[model samples]
Target: MKKIGIIGGMSWQSTQTYYKAINEGVNDHLGGLHSAELLMYSVDFAPIEQLQHNHQWPQLANKLSHAAQSLERAGADCIVIATNTMHKVADVMQENISIPIIHIADAVAVKLKQKGIDTVGLLGTAFTMEQDFYRQRLQDKHGIKVLIPDAPHRTCIHEVIYKELCHGHVYPDSHLAFMRIINELHFSGAQGIILGCTEIGLLVSQSDTDIALFDTTFIHAQAAVEFALS
Candidate 1:
């Protein structure tokens, strides 16, 4: 198997999920005693979060590029950025590394297309929700339609992601709030909901709702396994 490189710890909680899911995927594919062959450069999220909040994307991109270069030099075959929001700088990260960085949005788009979803709801950091990097890729590159919650709901989801989910805090009230937003998205003609934020899967899942829920953390991990095992 190829050695998968991960630039993680945008928030360690979701990074943990990526690590676990990728290993589980490999083990499930190869059976007993098999796990993913991987290397991870876990960054400190505090500075990264602060940069994001300040809209210091160029600085953030440099940081991510450094992490990807570290993984490449250490013998990782490909890279995975562990968070959705940070993918805004993915281009800079990719430019710095020779090995490919498996994009979370592309993985998600493939799954959505397979399910024949034409329109999907997105939930992530305010940057991801309001930015063009992610949604434009889905729409322009993959012919998918993207929908997001209204401004107030977008703010609520953003706060839940950083303040609550990133810190490993899950509350019933927060889940309820997410559910309400999901329902509204469904009513707004979303064929599915993309848990664009990696941490979101911690609070909600397919079992929590009838609308198709695409969790990028797991989907991206699964895609990494496919790349590694191929």
Candidate 2:
């Protein structure tokens, strides 16, 4: 099996989920004692968050690029950033690495297309939601329509992600609020809601809404496992 490299720690909460899910997925598929072969470079998220708030993407890209190079040297066959928002700088990071970067947006879009989903509600950090770099890629490259919540709702969701979910706190009240947002998307023509933030599945899930739920965390991990096994 090829070794998968993960650049995680945007929040340890979701990173841990990735670790457990990837291993469980591999074991379930192969049976017995099989588990994912992986290496992780968990960065201190404080600096990354600082860079984001300050709009210092160049520095952020340098950080991830260095992490990617280190993982490449350590024998990772391919790379996974393991976070959604950080992917704003994924290109800069991947350009210097020899291994393939399994981009989360591409992975999610592929899964959506295979299921015949053309439009999906996308919820994530404000950056991922509003940025053309991420949304346009899915639209222009994959022929997918990306739906984002409106201004006030967008702020609410972004706050919940950082203040609660990423902080390792899960509140029922927050899920209730998230459910309303999911329904808004459904009523607005979304057939499914993309859990675009890596940590979002830790909060809201398919049970929260009747609409189909596309969990990016699961989709991205499944893609990694397929690449590893191939």
Candidate 3:
């Protein structure tokens, strides 16, 4: 198995999800007690969260890059940053290392293609939603159309991601809010809703909505496990 590195703890809750899913997938695929061989550099969420709140991309890149370098030096073959918003600085993180960065969007697109989802509604932080790196990659590289909730709905989604999900908390009200967003996106033109934020699944889930839901966190975990095993 390949030694995959995870740069995580953008919120520890989602990082734990990655760790669990990766291990479980490895075991399932190998048909035994196999577990993923991984190097994890878990950054303290407070500093990263502060930078996120301030829109300080440069500082975030520096910190995350340093963490990536450390994981590389510790013998990780490739890296996966566990949060979607953290991927904003992924380019910078990759620049300082020889290892591949298993980008979340790229992994997500592969699954979307497998499912034949042409148009997807995205739920992520404001930066990830507005950023070109993610949406453009899905469009240009994967030939998929991306949709996002309208401004008001996006704000509500973002609030739930940060205020509740990050802490491993869930509220029915939050799920209901996301259900509304899913409805809006489906009405506006989306074949499925992609939970672009790793933590958002803590609230919204497949059982909660009628629109097709693409859980990026779950897909990302499955992809990481596949990469490590292959």
Candidate 4:
């Protein structure tokens, strides 16, 4: 198996899920003591969050680029950025690394298509919801339609992600709020929901609602495992 590199800790909470899921996936596929070959460079989320708030994407890109290079030098065969919002800088990260960057959205798109889901409701940081990179990729590359919560709901989702979920705090009220949003999206023709933020699965899951839920963290990790095995 190839060594999968991870740029993680855009909040250590969700990175933990990526680590666990990747190993579990590999074990499930190979059986008997098998686990992923992983090299992870976990960064402090505080400064990166601050840079995002200040619209310093170039600086954030530089930081992630450095992290990717470190993983490459450490003998990683490919890279996975653990957080969804940080993928805004994926291009920069890829430019600085020689190995493939397994994009979270592409993994998600593949799953959506496999489930015959044409339209999906996305929940993530404001950057991911309001920006075009992720949405356009799904639409253009995968022929999937993406739906987002309204402006007020978008703000609430963003707040819950950074303030609560990223810090490992999952409030019951926040859980209900997300459910309401998902139901609304379902009414608006979303065939499924994309837990676009990696931390979102910590708050909500497939059991929370009847709608199909795509957990990006799990999908992305599984994709990494498949790439490694291939």
lDDT of 4 by residue, 122-226 (tens): 999999999998998899999999999999999999999999998899999999999999999999999999999999999999988889999999999999999
Question: Candidate 3, residue 138: CA error in Å?
Answer: 1.2
Residue 12: error of model 3 in Å? 0.6
lDDT of 3 by residue, 35-137 (tens): 8998999998988888888989899899999999999999999998999988878888888999999999998898888888989988898878888878888
lDDT to native, each model: 0.94, 0.90, 0.86, 0.94
Estimate the lDDT of model 4.
0.94
Output the TM-score of candidate 1.
0.99
Better of 1 and 2 by lDDT: 1
* Model 4 residue 183 lDDT score: 98
Give the TM-score (vs. native) of candidate 3: 0.96
Tell me the tens digit of each residue's lDDT in model 2 across 1-230.
99999999998889998898889888878999999999999999888888998999999999999999999999999999999998899888878987899999999998888889998899999999999878988999999999999999899889998888879899988888888989999899998889999999999777766789988888899899889888
Name the regions of candidate 3 deviating beyond 4 angstroms.
none
Candidate 2: minimum summed lDDT over ten consecutive residues — where? Answer: 202-211
Off by over 4 Å in 2: none
Q: State the lDDT at 194 in candidate 4.
A: 97
Which ten-residue region of model 1 has the weakest summed lDDT?
A: 89-98
